[model samples]
Structure formats: C-alpha cells, structure tokens
Target: MMLGLKTLLLFGLGGQELLLIALIVLLLFGGAKIPELMRGMGKGVKSFKEGMKEVDEVKKDIENEVKKDEE
Candidate 1:
C-alpha cells in the first residue's frame, strides 16, 4: 500500500529532475547533517513567531495605557 501511494506520486516526476535536486541538497549539506539543519530551521521559525507575539502584546498594552490617560 505504501509503495503504491509513493509510486503514484513519483509517476508525475521525471528521473533527472529528482536526481538534480537530491545532488544539490547533498552538496550543500552532507547526508548526516540534514536533520540537524532542519531542526535549527524549526527553532528559528519558532523564535520569530514568539518575537512577533511579544511585540503585539506590547503594542496592545501601550494602546490601553494611552486610552486610560485620555480618560
């Protein structure tokens, strides 16, 4: 079943295209380092999201404080 599903997806790909992409990634980062690269990517994205959340909270608090000062 798994093999059948994978075959269906690969049916649309020509051999050399996949090979070219695989070679590029291999050259950029060796086989053993890809997982660590992906993990760091995930952490960077998470940190960016948290930073945005903190900025938004600070903006909201400032707006509330300004409103209180006006009243």
Candidate 2:
C-alpha cells in the first residue's frame, strides 16, 4: 500500500526531487519566516475574495436594471 502511494506521488516527480525543492525553499526563507509569508498570502487571498464579491454584486445590480427596463 505504501509503495503504491509513493509511486503515485512520484508519477512526475521523484521523492528526491520534491525533497530538494522543499530544502531550497526552507534554506532561502528559513523556518522562522514561513509563518509570516503564509500570513501575507492569506491576506492577499482574502482581499481577492472580497473584490470578487463586489464585482458579483455589481453584476447582479446591472442585470436587475436591464430586466426592469425590458419590462
């Protein structure tokens, strides 16, 4: 079972390859800075979601106005 799982994970990337990439990231940023990086990414994602909600609301308003005009 473990072997099958490992093979699935390594379909395109070997275990060594993944480990090397992770090691590079850790070395470049250090473990202490990872949380701060993740926090900033979270804030960015939240802001994007809020912006999308505003756009959707505006689209609904426009559609309602168009329907009223047709009536």
The candidate maximizing TM-score is 2
Which residue runs does candidate 1 get wrong by more than 4 Å?
1-22
Q: Which residue pairs show collisions in model 2?
A: none
lDDT of 1 by residue, 5-62 (tens): 4775678755676688678988999999989987998899789989999999999999
Candidate that would win on lDDT: 2
Task: Kindly report which residue stretches of model 2 are placed more than 4 angstroms away from their true locations once superposed.
Answer: 1-20
Give the TM-score of each candidate. 0.65, 0.70
Tens digit of lDDT per residue, candidate 2, span 1-71?
A: 47645885868777787788779989999999989987998899789989999999999999999999999
**lDDT (CA) per prediction:** 0.84, 0.87
**What is residue 5's positional error in candidate 2, in angstroms?**
16
Error of 1 at 56 (Å): 0.5
